[model samples]
Target: MEADYQPVSRTDAECLWASVRERASDPHAGIFGPSSISWKVNRESALFLGAGRAALLQLAHPWVAAALDQHSNLRNDPLARFHNTFRVVFTMIFGTLEQALAASRYLYQIHTRIQGAIPETVATYPKDSRYEANEANALLWVYATLVESALVAYECVLPPLSPGEREAYYSESKTLAALFGIPSHVLPATWLNFEAYSRGTIESAGLGVNDLSREMAHRVLQSKGTWVPVPGWYRALTTAWLPERLQEEFGLAFCRRERDAAAGARLWLPRIYGRLPATVRFTGPYLEAMSRVSGRGVGALTRTSNRFWMGQPRMMFAERGLGDAVELPQPLQ
Candidate 1:
């Protein structure tokens, strides 16, 4: 809500650019400090906001402001997309919208979470060092990106809003909806798909919590290291059809008991999936392979974006001495 936005100092910007690029690899060694994730977000705020903060004051809604304010996490820790939506929003307001969009590109690997509805996209490190972005995480990322981008695009088309307006200070749309616990459903029925998967999970597992409860519906959005917690259940269920040796390794009983017992389950993972073949260590779980092969999985990463540079922005943003200057940053984000 304040007009204090500005690009970060060059040194700060450089540091944050590195941190965000290294998000998956940042260590929890504490050397990076306790607030590394928030640090990157703030630095990005400065980088993207630059001198555009005041000019963009008319653009920020309340939820955007809050997201910029509340980015606390280690750089490598995984966070819910909804939890970290503001940093991307602010970057675009400042004309450096590239960062926001690019971060989404970096997350292409996580195409579906919560059955392609809830995305756990804004994953920071440390907390997520043990977790990999899985189906639910991917879904969360796309869902959040679509909602945020659409909301901003909406603002771009409407008459410019003014300050001192109540909606100007707070998000009346998506973020506000999420805050009241009535908001996340504003999404299309892809959300219903998420609900069905969750319900099926609970029922098949003999879980009795209402399908709509936060616990049952969103639990698959969690993880440990590179493994997705929700899909472990899928694997466990299907493990019954696996050879007995695989069943022993997959340990269907432990996975079921862990989630049913209300534990974070990462701590109990040895009982859940510690016995699986190491081939899955590099490749994710077998269920994901099924999703990929069956056409329900996240899409593979592609390098075609590099081709965008040859397009016209090169001429528009180019300088003569620099030679052809159209550029898109590396997709690694």
Candidate 2:
């Protein structure tokens, strides 16, 4: 892997982004082009900071919560659960066309096996109402939560993007949802529509807080069942960063002290993080993708910085293996 790393010139980065944007109009445009807004926003490590928030928001939906409670083992091995989700998300954002398609195909197969009835009724879904991961509405809910949470995380941990950039990012994100077999019509047509959808989901009575959602929320906040040790500040930030609606639904109380800590961290952490060299800010997959497109090796500074910035360097290196090129199936017609 070290042999493949090299410095990326500004000229190369611009060229790659330009090519990707040009191809964005092609439905058949490969998984991600340089012009892809996802690359611009998702390449930051700060995105992972929102993982707990995303999980909590998804669990707020009783059907989504019930599905995990019955068919998933999030508490049994949270690291693996997170890795599975993160692998698919990152692959879509940073992997080559073949890798993105391959990862999506794998996830689709996993979703096929995750269908069952909601054990208890919440809102319109009766106790026996069936829930399938592949169901259009259910899939849309999950997709929207993930996208919204990611953007929220981005805003919290990085410099704000222009409204236009955010819109372009949402448009690019739909392409990703499509890769998961969600029909285009089922997805929100624009960022404004998505915002409305998100607001409704958060405020809906259907998104009831239940025993299962509470338990899952606890595990996420405490970082239980995961291999990595979540920093105390990050855990606090997760609670503070969560939407007020979710905080109330989950029954999380932030004392004045905790709120102050969260506020200070939010203001300073991203500013400090932004000051880090690009080598320190980006992960290996992103670096490799830039190398592949620009025909240049990522710099040694990247590996050197990983040792300094990574909480667990072993896990960081392991992720590179996950992103290595893989055999890909043909695109769905």
Candidate 3:
């Protein structure tokens, strides 16, 4: 919260929206430096989504209305008005295609109570922040991405947008990129593609803050622009550095519970050994990259990855350099 926030500062909104546009690549900090997107505030932002349609009703921003409208019109078809925006800006990073579609339906479902938690959650952010602004397209796309992801993860479904429909989705997001003064080359060719899609939402690509998470959403809502503990909270899990509430809200604890399951050896192996070695801090770029993936891939011709979605797993032969390299004596100890 800004110290002098007046709830509706014409000047402040101007400055904030300007900063939001300016910090598109890295809006995790305040207008200047040092001030950041407090992870605590992010939980507040998620509260907004958790609040449901009532908050959506209270949310009067043109873009929010537009997204609502877009979602409504696309409910029957699911891809007509929202294909590319959903895919490139959102659908890829978080939830599955099925989850995205359910969120689509929920956002537009008629006469139903939109729920208390989501609306209450949404109320936490200062409405004037960039997340609700008309000019910041990245905020819009990423918000849609997150809302859809959270809904999908909770609902779990299949949102396969066909080839033709997919192209239309791509087209809409591209138009958004240009309208917001973002470079065309910056937009991702595919969702979660990171290469192209990351461009649509960056304040600075070189800084390495990509993907949507509660932390980034807080930045957008607060218009502060800092990248909080989003991309890799697991490292925080190892260090016990994250707030308990944020961790719980995002379900970090549930993942650890996997270790105790009877036959879930597949998930346990990666947690104990495939990941989290002793050679260095648990936070590594590789770990961060791996975090974005949901589900699994085959580890080789032989086995699986930490998650269970089943794509293709990557396999590497054991190496002999670097001081027993992360020598932790394996989980057998």
Reference-based lDDT, each prediction: 0.26, 0.66, 0.27
The stretch of ten residues in a row with the least summed lDDT in candidate 3 is 324-333
lDDT of 1 by residue, 1-333 (tens): 112222222343334334443433322221122233222222111111111211112111221212222322212222222223332322211111133234333223221110111122221211111222222222233333333333232232233334333232223222222211222333333434433533332233211122122221122223322232435433332233222432332223435553454333223443434354433221221222223235463223111211211112211111224433334321111
Clashes of each: 31, 7, 44
Highest-TM-score candidate: 2
- Model 3 scores a TM of 0.22
- Best candidate per lDDT, number? 2
Could you give the candidate ranking by TM-score, starting with the highest?
A: 2, 3, 1
Misplaced by over 4 Å in model 2 are 1-30, 296-333
Give the poorly placed runs of model 3, Cα more than 4 Å off.
1-155, 162-164, 172-195, 198-251, 256-333
Candidate 3, residue 325: lDDT: 22
Candidate RMSDs in order: 21.8, 10.2, 20.5
Q: After superposition, how far is residue 25 of candidate 3 from its true place, in Å?
A: 34
The alpha-carbon lDDT assigned to residue 80 of candidate 3 equals 24
By TM-score, the better pick of 1 and 3 is 3
